[model samples]
Each structure stands twice: as structure tokens, then as C-alpha cells.
Target: MSYVALYRTYRPKYFKDVFGQKVIVQTLQNALLHEKFAHAYIFSGPRGTGKTSIAKIVAKALNCEKAPTAEPCGECAVCLGIDKSSVSDVIEIDAASNNGVDEIRDLRDKVKYAPSVGKYKVYIIDEVHMLTQAAFNALLKTLEEPPKYVVFILATTEVHKVPATILSRCQRFDFKNIDTADIEANIKKIVNKERLKISNEAINAIAITSEGGMRDALSLLDQVVSFTKDEISEEDVYKVSGGLSRRFISELLQTIYQKQPQKALDFLNQVLQDGKDISRMVSDIILALRDVLLDKIREDKKYPELNGLTPPLIYAYLDILNELQQSLKYTTSKRAYLELAIIKMMNHQSIEYVELNQKIDALQKEMHNLETRLRSEVQVKQVESSKNIKVQSKSNLKPLVTVSEISEILNQGDREKKNLLKIGWPSLADYEVPQLRGVAKLLHEGSLEAVGANRMLLVYDDIITAQNMLKKETKEKVLKIINSKKQLIDDYTVLLKADWMILKDDYAYQYNAGISKPKLKEIDLHLYEQDEDSIQEVKLEEDPLVEFAKASFGENLVKVEE
Candidate 1:
């Protein structure tokens, strides 16, 4: 007799023998025990996850001579018949080949007949998603309301392709990929039972390569056992599976961390010479990086050579390798792509450092330009002071508007007018009126804080901006511009932000304390004005350095000091 593969030889006979699907086993057993099982059921998951195997076990349990048992009696004639696929009542259909309306129509017609030798006739359809629309439509009605003695078990790896109409009628069970630990334990049990001479490292390599598939693991084990007569080793597994050993992967990563491009390339060339797959090598490296990342996050010390690497660096390495892995699929020059990825990983830090240095240089140039502009402004102010012009010092500057005026405006502030003026403030920066250009520039430097009747208050971040806005010529031009816009403001004044905040707080305290408004006073507004000649019109020229700073960083991040 031909040798049976391990997967088939160790195929689960009873629910208890099924591995890595405890929840599914228990649920099906309970459903069978209570006799409340659905007439139609769908099993969906990855391949080799026991979807069809469990379906067959369910058929055996339903048809076992001792009826309604959770665990089937494999010795019964009906159980033995179903196991051998000799039972006429249990039919397993491969939907990939028989997916058509004619086949489903035949099934619909045959459902009316009674079971041949068992109490229930079970129909197990594999890869049910392969069925065409017409076939699904033909099966829908019968699947929803099948005969009492008929059971339909639909299994598919890609459940998304299955129609909602067909899915809605059946009870769906989603099988998960078997865990690596569980797969490892199962492989060990098989090895011990078969008396196969295999090392633990070989078993682990098989389990990891399987990627959570039990059948794949067992199939790999069978191949490895056939290849080697002596005790199997990890090297044997890697050689057979076209995978890089973990030690080689660790050494490659260490060379990368040490920034030894030559050494890393040497390792790559060696692997290629050994006939290992380039894409598989990249995948192994990514997996090794993943392990290092987890160790770093968990504060564990597993890879000492990788101890110098940071999480962010590992993440970047993974990103580069992952991109290379994707690009390898469509490219013929796989070696060139892998070489380029290794070089990128080696120079990642240097590249990031260069970029950071460039940013710092730009910021230094901006600061120097700012300092030069401030010094020039200081010189102009000094020249004005020599002419005996009354220029208020920033620290000792007084508010242009009196406390009484502020109190009167705040007490009777118009919410609607203030909101309107606030909305229109941004437009002043791009004003087209030539005569009001300087006024627009000054107003744009400050913000409209309050509006009362025909009076307004503007606040600025610095004393220089407030003083310039309060200059006699700037204020007159502003009034003319406002009148042109039909705003008709009687007067406006400027104050520093710090002073405004204090005044605002005091006013709020008085209002909340129910204090009455102060008596109105007709004070001379000329006291607040500065000589027109002393405060020159702000130039409209755009500073290229400032613009560059704004463009390099952003407008919101760049601030003009003066």
C-alpha cells in the first residue's frame, strides 16, 4: 500500500481528536446534544483550518448508529462508511468544479428523497464562494428551508464573495488560524508518536514557517522526515523550506546596526550563493526586526547585537524592507532591489541627520535676519529721539485710550458690530486703497478687540506696534479708510496685549460685582497722538528672508519680531 501522508493519517476521527478548535468543537457538540442544530450551516476561514474536516465529523456524529451523540462511535458501520466516503447519505461536493445552475437544480430535486442508510442526509460543499450567481440563487431557497432530514454545510476560504442572501439563511462559523504554540505542540506529539528523530529547532522552524496552518505544518514535517534519515536539524528545515536561519538573520541585522555595508552585502551575497530566495530573505529579516521591536517594547534582552538599535530605527528598517518585498513581485532584478534596501537601512540615520541640520541652518538664518531688522528699527528710533520726538518707551508706554473711554466702550459694547469688524479685519492686510496702505499695514499688525457705537479698540502683541498704530497720521488714515468702507467709526486706540488683558479682567470683575458704569468724560484725544514725522509709514516691501522662513516652515510657525 502507498504511504498515507501525515495529515490524512492523523486526520481527526472524533471531535475530541480535533486540534486547535476547542470552541467550535464544543459548540457543535452542544448543538448536536440538544438536537437544535441548524439545517444549513456555513464554515468560513483560512485553508487547512479544519473547515471541511469538522464538517465531515458533524456528518458522522449525526449518522452514527447510536444517534445524537456528540462524539461519534468510529466503530459503527455508518461511521465507518462515512469515514471511507462510502456512505450514500453523506455527500461531499467540491463546489469549485460543480458550480453551476444545473448541478444546484439537481440537488434541489434530490433533497426531497430520504436518507439511504442514516437518519440525516448531509451535503458538505467545499469552496462554496466559487459557485456562480445563478448557482447561489438556485441553492438559496432550499438552503433556507431544507427537508428535516437534510443538512447543508457550506465551506469557503473567501466568505466576502458569498452572497448575503445565501449567507443570511445559514448559521456561519468563522474558523481562526491555529496558533503557533498549538501547532508546535501538535507537531511534537506527532513526532514522538511516529518515533521520528527530529531536533526541537527543526520542529520550531516548521511551526514558524507554517504561519498558523496545521496541515501545512504537518505536511512540511512529512517532507523533512522523508528527506533526512538521521536526526533532523534547523539547517535541514531551512534548506528544505527555502528560508534563512534565525542566526544568519541576526548576524545580518547586527552588521546593519554596526553600519558595515560591506559586511552586510557579503552576508547577502553568501545567502544568494547558497540559492536561498531573495524575497524570503527579506521576509526573514523583517520578522527578525519585529522580534527585536517587541523585545525593546517589553524591556527584554534577547538580541544583544540589536541592543544598540532603537524602536524608531527598527520601524524604518521594516518599512524599507517591506517596500522592497512588495517591489520584488514585479521586478526581475531582485538582487539589485535587495542591495538598495540594505544600503538605505545603513544610511537611514545619516540621511535623517542631514535633514535635521538643514532645518537648523534655515532657522539660524531667520534669527539673524530678525536680529538685524530689530537693530535697524532701534537705530531709527534713536535717530528720532535725537530730534526730541516724544517716543514712548515700550516698558513705560501708556494706553492710548483712557480707562474711562475703555469702561464706556466695554459697558456698551455691541456684539454684532464687533463680530462684523472682526470678520472684516483680515481683509485689511490686502487692502487695494493706495492712500490707506500704511494704515492697512498697521491695522493688520493688530486685531479689533472691541466695538462700541462708532468707537473701537485695537490690541497688539508688542509696544512698538501699538505705538505705531496710535501715531497721529496712521490713526487719521485709518479713520478715512473706515469711513470709506461705511463703518463710520468716531475714533480708535491701541494697547499692548498684556495691558488689555489686565483691563479686561478688571472690567469683568466690576461687571460681575454689579458695579454701575463710570460717569462719561469728554477728554482731549490729542494727548494720545504722536508727531506724524516721528512715526514713518511702514514700507510695503516683502522681506525675502521672512518669506523663505514662512515657506520653509509655515506662516503660522513664523513670527515677525518687530
Candidate 2:
């Protein structure tokens, strides 16, 4: 004459009794009616979703004399045996306790025998993922080709740990967490049956505490019921559960709205003094603040999933209190943390929240102010630089290129006179070669073709030679040269283009490697393949400085071998 816990007392005995598992129940039922059940089935999902319960139901449906029936008659002998867990044909194993390879081998041996009492022998293994690798291997062969009269039902909370080979052999069904609404409805039925006068709010609190686990929810209800034989109160539920009252939490917000830090701390201190846990207090606060935050947004189904808690209250609660969660463990003094948190909110101007929204607003304002100041500073610098440039314009204009007198290199000769103009005295091409420091030298000397106004092209006498010199590294360096100098000529629309107008016999630089023909082909093939599916075709445009990149690397690097 011992009391059966509420969860077990109300455990689903038939498919019609299982809550929030209609989808899974329907699939199994259909499979049963059609005689299409798999030899091995894997049921995987979160806790309390009834993986084992469904497995048992399947066992019952299969073993019942009249089945291929969706609703197994609990009155039948086979159903009664399964209900009592004494069915010879149905064996339930906890893989967590018996996860050794030997256990799996033993099960495999047992599965080969014919059903002793029913049409099929069903083995339901819970926590199947806990089985060791060798156990999984041992189970796999049986799964692949089990006797027609044998069924293996493997249930697991974590399916990923199950080996792919085993998984590949079984039919997998993922169970989902039961919704709060479903749990709440069931709790109401229980309260009605027990003849207890319970408030909707107290029932909800229990549902939320259960966190979608029906057994936990019912166990909690059983505990709450023991407090009073005929009735349960919300206060009694709160006191027993170690959770904050929704009103106490709602009042915390009223304090925040009123901007009363002292009063708020006093309320928080009273709650802690009443034996309420600070972590649980913070958790309650976070939930309240989240509700408050949600109030400012759209309402989703998750709010209803909160049992009986109202949406607006949850919104207000989650908004203001979720803040204290991270800082909860840092303080030994719970009242002090509450005191500090409330005081900081009271003086929003002085608080430093690294990621706080208030601080973010202030920081954004600060950023705008700083940006305006930086822009003013940059403008001032530019003006001063312009003034300095005017003063030095005359001196610097003396064609600072040391070889400025060599008109061919500068490409700035006298077009009208048909001869290179000499400027800056002593035939001015002499401004220190303007150091085509990077691949600017290659462009200056002539190698690829400038196909776009934005491109620096280098063209050779033969296309093969031009493509050959476009080594991956060399192309990158040349691109940097084109972009950098093009930035210098702000208004001119400067495009770099190079052509070996004359195969210069005078320029000679020996290359250590062979033609590098193989490397060139690989590079072209790689780049070409990427563009083969679709090409960005456009009218070819010209750039002016590409002659420099090809030539700068040395004449042989770009010019055809003559």
C-alpha cells in the first residue's frame, strides 16, 4: 500500500494516453496496421519525450493477438504482460548499465531465437548511444540481418554518438520535447482526478519547472500535493520549489520604473532573507526581464510555453532583470549584488556596461562626436599640406626623375614636335629614375596588355610570351603598382598599358630557369578554369603605365627571347 508517484501513476499506457507524441504515435500505428515495421528502429530525441514509452507501445501493438491494430487492447494477456513489464516477448534493457560488447553479443544471440509467446520478440534498449564502440559493432551485424520475428528498438537522447554503421541499418525517429500546453492540460486532468482545488497559476509553475519533462512535472506535483491533502496553493508551490513569485518579480520592475533603488534593494533583500536562493532569484529576474524585452517585440509561441505565466509580465521581467545573471556568482553577498545592480540602473549616466544597451547609446553618440572631430582634423591637415605643396611646387616640378632627360621612359615627350621635350634644365629626364620600386619596373619596360581603363596592361610582340611572364606573384606585384600610381593622378583617368613597340636588343638580363613553360601553363589553366563557366566580358579599355611593370623585372622577364 505504498503511494505511486503522480508521473508513474498517470504514465501513458495506451497510444491515446501519450501526450504531445501524436506524430510519433501515428507513424508507428500506421506501420503496425500495414505490417511494414522495421526490424531495427532508433528513437532519438531530448529527455522526457517518451522514446522508451513509444517503444513499449510498439511492442504491445506487435505482440497483442489481435493487432496490426493501432490501439492495443490493454485487457489482452500480451498487452497486460507488457503493461506489467513481465512479457516474455518484450525485453527492455538500459544500455547505460549494460553497454559492454559482451552484453551486445548476448543480445544478438538471444535475438536469433524464435518468439517464445508472441509473433515477434521485441527488445527495447534505452540510452543506446552509451554503448561502447565494440558494443555498437557487435549490435550492427544483428541489426543488418536480424531474424524476421525479432525487433530491436534503440532509444537514445544523444544520437550522434551512435555509430554511422549502426545508424545506417535502423529506422531513426527523432522525438521532440512535449510542449508546455500539453503538459499543462495533463496536469489539469490529474488535479481533477485527484479532487484537488489548484489554481491555474500553481499548475503552470509546476509545468514550467518540469521544463517539458512530464515525469519531472508529475513528480513535482506529487510533492506539492503532499503539503495539503485536498488542495495546493501557489505560495506553497513557490516555497517548496525555490522559485520567485511572479508578483515579487513584477514588483521588482515597478521599483525600476519608479527609479527607487533603495526600495528595490530592500525588496530583494527580503526575498533572500526569506530563504530564496540568489541564483534562482537571478534566474527569475532574467525570465522577467526577458518578458519585458519581448513586450517591446512580437509575441512568439515560446511565451505560451512558459506554463501559466502571462506574456506581459514575462516581457517586463526579462527586460530589466536578465542583467543580474552573469554577475550572480561574483558576489558572496546576494543583497549587495542586488543593491549594486539597482543603484547602477538608478544612475544610468555613470554606469559602465561593456555591452549594455544604455552604454551602447552613449557610445554611439560619443562615436558621432569623435567622427566629426576627426573629419575637422583631417580637413585642417589637408589644407596645411596644400599650402606647403604650393610653396614647393616649383622646386619639386623640376621632373624629379633622374632620367627625365631620357624622354622614352617618362612617356611625356613633345608630341607636337615629334621629339622628347627636355624640361627642368640639363635635358630633365634625369630625375632619379623615379624608382619604379615594385613591379612598376615591369610595367615601365613593357609586358601585359591594359584591357580596361582601370587595368595596367603589358603587351608583348607575341601573345605566348606575354602570358608566360604572368607568374602569379609577378601579376599580384604588378597590380599593386598599377593601383598605387593610378591613385596619384587624381584627375587624368590614368590607365597603365604596355606594348613591346620594339623588341629591344640592348636590354639583357639572364634568367636562371628554363622558359618556365610548365609553370605558365598551370597558372593559365587554373585561372581559366575558374572563369570557364561564365565570363565577365567587356569592351577592352587601355591603361598607360603597364609598360613599366613588365620592363622593370628585367627585359627577358617580359620581352620575347630573340
Candidate 3:
């Protein structure tokens, strides 16, 4: 009983003493110094952010016999009475208990009368927003025109809910939540002031747990002080508050970074087995990752907790968490989330999360730069293909084009298909072709040879690929799309022809370092590398065929028999 709560004991007695609302406090101080106090005042902000505290300070300042000033002399008789809650004229009404229209009417009647003892009759209504609409209506007239001796000080957490009619008649002052640094410093001040021995880490835990609320921070400190004798340790602080453990989160993220899903899963299992809720773990991972993101972003702050790791490392850890969050919806398991997150973390090229972010960002910017260049190159290729299409319209009277020309027309397709399937396939599906045209993923590659009108010998390679593409679901999809029956040509097709062998791997052809990639790049570069050296220098010829004839002469070599 001897020890009062830190927030309560440390509650500001004067305007200058109120924390984190300098603007409001200064304005109040100026008002008091000028003897320009408002009839009714509203103080609003988040809880534990000094709304009510400031209101009480204002009440004491106006009524304090020491003279109206921002820094009220706390030793004054009026200030002492307000502090002791024994002031007769200064009524502190809990609107929560007295929220009816009758209460407002009764209060309204009383406001018309003069203060019994003091110069001003101050009404400090906490949670003033709880007043019924009827109560507010009854209070509005009294709020708009109170006697010189009466002052109304309303405090609420929800200023948004307060009626405009009530707000218009009163002076509004808003309070702000304390910052993390301020909270930490205040805790340190208290520890030093009280001669209590607590670790810096414990002080930090209290600060972080407070989350920018001074009252909450004080409460945490109070609990820690009560739990253990005078000296509170960091471990005790953490146990008292089940906040997300940063060490555990970092370790889980490291496993994710390793991409060892099995190991990551095992680690996740341990967390779950530790009696931690998956949702809580997932939420903590997100917050810790958020802190990681903050650490990455607030590079200028040089936060002590974010020391050692660079911005890039923080970002890499953040990126891992971001990836984990993406896959969270697929499975509700905490283990799964942790595993996926850690696995992603493992894949990061940079071991440091901050390094990964910067590198990732740099690489992303570079990739974007590359993409812009690639798109410009592609657009140039597309324009060239468009020109060639017009050119081919005149000189080429042929229905079926050559393999290289087939490659040329494919430039107009979406970048994905062009990059994925490549113009390896001949014609559009259901396109009227010479039967050889539709079989390009095969025919041009020597999988099919023309024998007669509609018959062709399906070669072994084409047979294999077609077999894979025509698998159960694929066959269903193909049958739905093409409306075709397989004409088994070779012994290979007859023996092993169930599904079409569409290569799952886009670079599977390039899997052989020596063979596959070079050929693919050769083709990609060959087809894509068509444009005037200086696009601005090009003169438009009447016949588009002239440009193509020149380009063909350059590299494309349109394979026109003319």
C-alpha cells in the first residue's frame, strides 16, 4: 500500500509535466498565462496517453491560487485539494456510470450556478463519449454558454465518436502516445530515481511491451518490480509478458533461410510443442519480421537493438517472413508456416537478412532495369515482326512457312509462351495447316516426316514428347481442345505412346550445360535480335519487304525460296 503505481504517482501535476503532448500542453500553458481559459475543453487521444492527466492538470491550473501558469506550483492548497480528490467545486464524474440524459440535465442545471468555493466550477468527465445522445443534446446548450466561473473539461479515448455539436462548443486538445525511446528513457529515469536495480534489457522489455503507452510501460515495470524484489531481470520481464521472443523468431528465420524444409519443420514442431499457439507464433513471426523490416528501413536511426546487422540483412529476414506469410493460407499449421518461412530464408543468396534486402532491392531494381531493356528489345522485335508480317504478305504467297519463319511469327505472342514453349511448335491450335504446320513442337525438330497428304511418320523424339503431353489429364485437356486421335507412326509410338512428353522444365533442354542453354540462347537471340541499328536513322520505305529483305540479308535469312 505504501508503493503507489508509477503512472499514478508520476501523474503530471502541471501542464509542463504532462508527457508527449507538447503542443496541447504549450497551448494550455499559453491560455493560462494569458488568463484566456475556455469555458469547456475536450482532451482526446489513445488510452494511457495523458488525456485525463492533462485535463486534471488544467483543472488544477485554472483553480490554483498560485496564479494561472503552465507550470503550476504543486504545493498550493488548491492543487493539493485537486490532487487529493477532495475539491468540492472540481467534480470528476465518470460518464460511464452517469451517462443518462437526466445526469446531463442535472449537471446542466448545476453549471448555471456559480462555483461554491473556487473562482471556477470545473467538471472533469472521463470517457465523456459514453454520454447518451440525449445526454449530449442536454449538455450542448450548457456547453455553448457556461458562466465565467464554470469550466467543463471532457476527456475521451474516442474523439471520433464525440458529436460535432458538442465539439463545436468546446476547445479540443489532443494527446499523443509516448514514443519507444521516451518510454525507455522514462523507465530508466524511474529505476535510477527509485534506486532500483534492473537490467537495461529489462528496461527495454518494459518499453517494447508498453508499445508507446507510458501507462502500460509503467504497469509492466510495476508488475516486474512486484514479482521480484527491487532488482528485476530481463528473463523475469519476458516471462511476465508473453511477448514474441526475438531470438526464437530469428532462429526459425535462419532455418527458413537454409531452405532445409525438414529441419525447418522440426524447429517449427519444437515451437508448437513448446505450447505456443501457431497463430501467435505466426503473428510474432510477422511482427518480428516487421521489426526486421523497420530495422532495414530505419537505417538512419541506428537503433541499438538493430546493431551489428546491416540494412541488407534485416531485409533478407523480412523478405523471408513476407514469403512465409504468402504461403500461410495454404496450411493453418504453425509448423508449416515456420518451415516455409525458414526455407525461403535459406534460399536467400545473402546469409544476412539486411544484406539480402539491399541486394534483393538492388537486384530487383537491376532486374527492373533489365526488364525494361528486355521489353524495349522485345518491343523492337515485335515491331520488326509486325513489319515482316506485312512484308511476308506481299512476297510470300505460301501457306506453310519454314521453321525459321515459324520462329519469327512467334515474336508477337505473350512473352511467357515465347519464353516457355518457344516457337518450337509450328501452328496455332486448330489452325488450317498442311497437317505438318500444327505439329511444330515436333515436325521442325525431326519428330515427324511428311509421307503423303495427311499422313506423316512420327519420329522417336516427337513421339516421346507427344506421349507426355497427352497424359491422362493432359489428354483430356488436349482432346477437349484439339478433337484429335493419335496416328501412331513409329514402333516407339506404338510401344510407348500414352502421354505427350511436354518438358516440365523450361530449361530442361538447357540442363546439359554444354548443349542445352547455348542452343536456346542462340535461338532466342537470333529471333529477338532484329532492329535498325539506330531506330531514329531508319527511313520508312514504301514497301515493308525492303526492310525484311535487308534484315534477312543481315541475320534472320527468312528462308524464302525466291
RMSD vs true structure, all candidates:
11.1, 19.8, 18.0
Q: Model 1: residues >4 Å from true position, as ranges?
A: 297-304, 349-562
Q: Per-residue lDDT for 1-562 in model 1, tens only? A: 9999999988888888777889989999999988888999999999888999999999999988887888899999999999899999998889999999999999999999999899999999999999999999999889999999999999999999999999999999999999888888888999899999998888989999988788998999998988899999998899888899988888888888777999999999997998999988888888878888777767655466677676667777888888898999999999999999899987876546645676788899999888655544443433234233434333343446676877777777888988877777788888898878877877887878888877888877654566677777877888887777676588887765555666777777776778776443333222244544555444344454565567767999999997
Q: Please name the candidate that would achieve the greatest lDDT relative to the true structure.
A: 1
How far out, in Å, is residue 11 in model 2?
A: 0.6
By TM-score, rank the candidates, best first.
1, 2, 3
lDDT (C-alpha) at residue 213 in model 3:
85
Instruction: Give the best candidate by TM-score.
Output: 1
Instruction: Give the Å shift of residue 109 in candidate 3.
Output: 2.0
Query: Can you write out model 3's per-residue Cα lDDT over 1-562, one digit (the tens) per residue?
Result: 5868888888777666656777887788899889988888998888888887887887788877866666667887888888998888889989999999999888887877777665788999999999999999998878888888988899999989899999999988777778878888878877888889998878877887777788998888888888897578776776576554566666655555444667667766765665665555666666665676566556554233434445455566666666666666677664656655565565545554455566778899998886555544443443344332322222223322123332222222234422222233344343444443344333234333222222222323222343344334433443332333343221111111111122212224545545432222212211111123323333344334444345545646544354
TM-score-best of 2 and 3 = 2
- Per-residue lDDT tens digits for candidate 2, residues 342-427, read 66655544232322555577799998886655543433332223222122222222221121111122233223222111111121
Clashing pairs in 1: none
